[model samples]
Target: MSLPPHPSSSRRSRLDAYQSLDSRSPTTTPTLSPPLQPFAKRVDSFTSSSSLLSLDSPYLGANRPLSFGEQKLTSSKFTLPHNHMLYLTPDFKEDDDELHMPEPKGQRLGIERDGDFASWRGFVNLGALTLVIVAWIALFAGYPIIYHFTSHRWTNLGAFNLGGTNGTGQVPIMPFHFAVIDPDTPPSAYSKPSWNDPSTSMELVFSDEFNVDGRTFYPGDDPYWEAVDLHYWETNNLEWYDPAAITTQAGNLVITLEAKETHGLDYQGGMMSTWNKFCFTGGYVEANVSLPGLNNVAGLWPAIWTMGNLGRAGYGASLEGMWPYSYDACDVGTVANQSVNGVPVAATINGDAGNGGVLSYLPGQKLSRCTCQNANDDPSKGLLVHPGPKHGDGTFVGRSAPEIDMFEAQVGGGDVPTGEVSQSAQWAPFNAGYIWQNTSTNEVIANPSISVQNTYIGGITQQATSVVTNTDQNCYEGVLGCYSIYGFEYVPGFDNAYITWVSNNQISWTLNGAGLAADAAVEISARPVSQEPMYIIMNLGMSHNFGPVDLPEIPFPVHLKVDYIRVYQRADQKNVGCNPEGFPTIDYINQYAEAYNNPNLTTWVGDYQQTFPGNSFLGQC
Candidate 1:
């Protein structure tokens, strides 16, 4: 077989072509190369020549050293297929055999070079798509963490599922010793019928042990608690709420109600609040309290409750909630059933009977004052409607009633029995009916038996003497007195499910912190109007329902003492906290408290009107 064309010969042929273009050659008729053989035969001939040329070929390096390109082509490691010709002549015609180049050895671009190059692009596209999808999922799942560091507001979406002292994602604090259900434990351990802690969750968020003795609550004396100076008119209590009446002693908060007249009221009492300071949506809340007097303490009323942050305590109905009701909804019923103007008021706003209508004009109806529309004297014009003011994340912080009465221990008034306390929640339902009055005749029509003022849509009383008793005298006042842990756990976002209140009314109690059986006292559902962020309020007042004060039985200078107050909120719920839009920041709240504490700065630092600008206090116009 002939050897492949030498490098010198190929270069010499190219030179000869150039010489022929300049010099004359005999113009002889070209002989057609003996009737050209088939193209495959030519390829076979070329392959034979290439196969003969090897690394030890005498033709190689016989003349001179090979150039870099020529050496690479002649290397023993590089070989071309004997049947496939990668190189084609200028006039090459189509042939039966396909042309192929040498495949790469080993890995190329991180993939096996098995000659399937086209598939690499498909694999790369699929890999890129997978990475993008995973990136999006991580971003969405970690949003709360990112928001915490970047944003200035607080959110209830809670931090990441971090390890905490009390189960998962909960801060360690003094756990309520009376809890009957351990959320962290399995349900099968309990013998009685069980439900989740109220709404299946609990995490400690706020706590105040009143650890500092002789601590006086005067405006800014305490960071979390403050005293209110006002005559509370919502319940028409005879006593004026005085800030000077609140103090702490022996690790307990004390509120004294005395006969000394103040602020035009014949009597004076004490009120403490956590307004505009800290608030939460829903969770377990509890406090250890000692009542001022026995259950039959004629007019004395002591309460531990919560109210939405959109209302200030001292302000009248304009800035304060209507107590126990959220945003208003008016329902339509027959005149005989609703008793309004001798005619059925049309349900024009919210649609039909079940859904409440907007607070608009209602002829001779007294409902405008009954609902949140009481903020405006003439709500018929529809000037201000909730969800009223836009705040954090542009969500409306409503100026509506969202109250949860944990316990109001009283007697000789309302439906409460002597020695028993009441636990309840309240809200304005869409089906709430209204009373109407005649324009000229001045006659009112309604069911005399059903008064909305004293009615409790959702309520329950403490267990009877068999379950709880105060005979141990383990409390203040020394005479048949006792201390009891009273509290309730609230869960929002349920449809028509009444709230559950938890109480361990034992005067001298045990931890019995396990599962509890389902019973009437704890299972009574109340109106669910407490969906917003509510602050804490503890006060002592005189109730009109109990008639005149029994001065002899519960005389002047009565005391309502509290051992501690703590709050546990749902870890997975949404909440608004310090520095949220339209709300004061923790630093600002502290700054105000500092100024209030300064005796030289006589002017009140928390003048709601001046301190909070650009909108009305609690969004009340």
Candidate 2:
């Protein structure tokens, strides 16, 4: 009774809004049946297997032409697979009554024809609408594969989580060795420790329990000794001392660095040292190296310096005097300060220098000296002998006794009578109390019990009634440098200048030379006045900035290995038991050997405390 429109004509309705082919035009046109059109020999080829037809053929003779009726016949192979062509099938059965409706009256040409045409058009219209809805759904719900390949990241966030692959964990965390440069010491004398290999280990012990920090110096920087380089020598080289060259090998330490060269260096390098970060402050620190290099020059040097808990903070202080000129008037003829946070500080009793103050380093009682002087007799000299001609710290010699030198002058000697003079070198010793009277000019500053010329090892001095005066200015108001903040110089040589601390103060301290206990010695004094914990640092530095030397070559992969650095914190269960900042005693110092995967617990690094060039958040000034 009806035939479908041609494929092209069927899709025309979807392309334009023109007055469509009149719906009322002609339904009686006998709906072009197969009798008016040609058909293919393979009729089932037009219909997919899922439809009512299927095609499976072995041959179709070249000249064969299927008859009209045979060409219209469809296959009944119902077992074939499904496909899009299945939609073309007449969905009704031969016996289906509704599909067998009488021919529509559309040929009548008016309202009736229009009604008939509309009924047939309804099926096509419904199909078009359904197809549109399906296409829209697929577009919105699917994630396009093309998008994934273009953007490197899954999202537009543009960031990634790298995890812990960064390289910070790979560096060795502990400082393994230390080398000191004092005014009196010779530069070429650099050698290896008596224990461990020079390139792999160090035999220096600096524990909070054994608080024996030493001092070092650079040219024109030892505001304390004020050493005058008569030869104007320069010290810019250092090396790793091997085991065959060490002096002592404590079970806790490996090798030592004893002066090996005979030609002395007179630069005012600082008497730098450190403590803790490894051992408790109540611990002990001992180095078996001596100053065969420091025959007579003044100026101090430090081997170690620790605090109650200095390893954790940026700035801190605890009773320790490794660099005496750093605070006391040890280099009285020179001008330098020993201070903290830009304030004058002292920690020794050398003569009239500490007259009004106790052995404890206090604020106001700084050993005051006269105005700075350029010449040897200006009476005032600057502490800390740095490299520049105008630099301070080197107006004197290291290891030598101090005197006014009002008569016979030396390079750093003074040329004035604060009051009078007593060339007698008869300064008395400190027992409890003592006195003296300078009948000439009568200028008395202090009358400390212990006093004697050449006898007072490394501190300031003043007879019975003489105007109190400070000599070294290393720790003095350091113009605009590191000491500028802490007015006093942190000299390494002073009274019992340096005291050692162990897990408790009972730890013993001894010095040795060539691997045996010798002349180098130290006794523990009272604790520092600060409340901060301590840290450890070993460096062969020149005053402030550090630079590579041009003369000597630094072998790649060379190391300053530390055999061990034992620490002892007097277990008080109260106060000094743990660190003030890095408390609870974080692993008694990492003592690892290899440079990777830190396994031991007695290691630390000096790079963590660098300042000046830039401030190190860990243990900085």
Candidate 3:
């Protein structure tokens, strides 16, 4: 700017300066100014002897070979390596256009898109929904199937045939009903005995004549008879009562006993009872029957007996104490306030309905209340006597429940006496000491113990009051064979003050021949008295109490036949002590449900159903 030098002089100075810079460093030359391009071109072609323009000049063309030091400078940090360099065409120029990378494409980008993810989400949701539906179906369908075989229908298929129909109607498993029998004899044809002069004439109150062939006596088939299909726990018998085993043929009610495994027992038998159907008080009851033959009589205990209406045949309850107590006067002035099984009996029909309460008078019946002060007043007077009305735990007990046995005949086996039949009256005066009583306060005692507080009378043992054995083969065979007539005559003290029992082998076709003569040959008792109402129970049982059954010797199927059963009451004293009202209805469904839920109560081990203390039968006395 201040007096600039000549161009040639300036250029020469610049070239000399560039040469000086190049000589300082042989590998690199300083960048030539843009205005000195002509000078650079000239220097590139120069081939001079001078060192500045020699062939070894640092200012070389692009095609010139680089020296070792030049090669080292090419790899400086300022420049990129050949492999990392952007690809370019041979004619590529550094222009203003933007670079274009390959269009971005990958799986990760596609997954982030909402449209594609929605489909994936739907599939996942469908899978989750399907799983939920499957779970719901499994819950609903599986429960009842699991519950059915394990709990429901267990007893119906195993323990007893609880559901079925006879020709009559639908039959319930409980409150069993029996057959009604109309006797061939008319009331007017019978003559009054000499002992019944003041009493009215005898009228037939209950009768059952087995005249119909192939008549079934199952539950609901007959109004007067019901069969029990259960194991008899009282005597620990080896027989299970089968309803199918009781039938009638050839003018007789037949109870068949079969030696086969039934339920848990080694045998099956037939048992019929008039429970809740026909009951009598002061009356004359008679039955003609034939016992099982002596061929395979081992462990056979066939019998005819009567129990109070307050007890069920094969169930456990506080009311079962009503049996074995034949005398009604045993409880006179005592306050019957005691509860049974913790159930208060202050208010119910006959004191307590199902808890073993006293049922003295029935509907449309007369009450014959009396007190005990004489020989009959003593509870310890007969065989199978009970102690006074005091529990073992110092608690007051209820009234006495009584039973009367027309005959409990023992078939010969082991220590049991054969050909011997026993007749007795039994009672339980104390509330404790029975399987049906409160176990916490009482010990089970079927027979009375000799104690200081009560009088022990003659023939007061644990068994029968009297036993009779027939040695006459004519009494068992011939036209009169197995046709013995057993009669129980009770004349309440109102008009006649005597009770009579007659056993005669005489069979009369007409009602006139069935007379109660006071002959000593057929008369058994004239002293015992019972005023309470009673029901009839007939069964063919095999007892371990007698002896184990000789299985091979058994005639497979044995029969006990009964021609007829008749009950007679004075015309003026009809329905006097009878229980016109049947037993209370039980909730068997709830009972079964309870058994199903409780593992301890279910009968799953050795047997098909729960029997005794593990299971309880509902009853109302």
Candidate 1 residue spans exceeding 4 A from truth: 1-201, 320-324, 328-399, 413-417, 429-480, 496-498, 505-528, 546-548, 574-621
Which prediction has the highest lDDT against the true structure? 1
Candidate 3 regions exceeding 4 Å error are 1-183, 186-201, 295-298, 326-400, 411-418, 430-464, 471-481, 492-498, 505-528, 546-552, 576-621
| Error of model 1, residue 469, in angstroms | 12
- The local lDDT score (0 to 100) that residue 22 gets in candidate 2 is 29
lDDT of 2 by residue, 1-621 (tens): 899888888677654422332232443121212232223233565565333222333223223445655443423222222332354577734555446556465533333543544555797888889988877766664445444543222111101101110011111111222212222222332232221112432222222111212322222111111111111112222332122322122221112223333234322221122222122222222232111111112111112223222121111111111112111122221221222332222223222344554232321111111212222332353322111122156322111111111111011223531111111111111111222222222221132221112222222222111121222232211111111010000112222222211111111111111111111111111111122233333322121111222222211221111223332222221122222322222221221112111112112233222111111111221
Task: Give residue 138's lDDT in candidate 2 (0 to 100).
Answer: 60
Q: What's the best-to-worst order under TM-score?
A: 1, 3, 2
**lDDT tens digits, residue span 268-324, model 3:** 998877654456766777888776756224556777888655445664332332334
Candidate 3 lDDT trough over 10 residues, lowest sum: 360-369
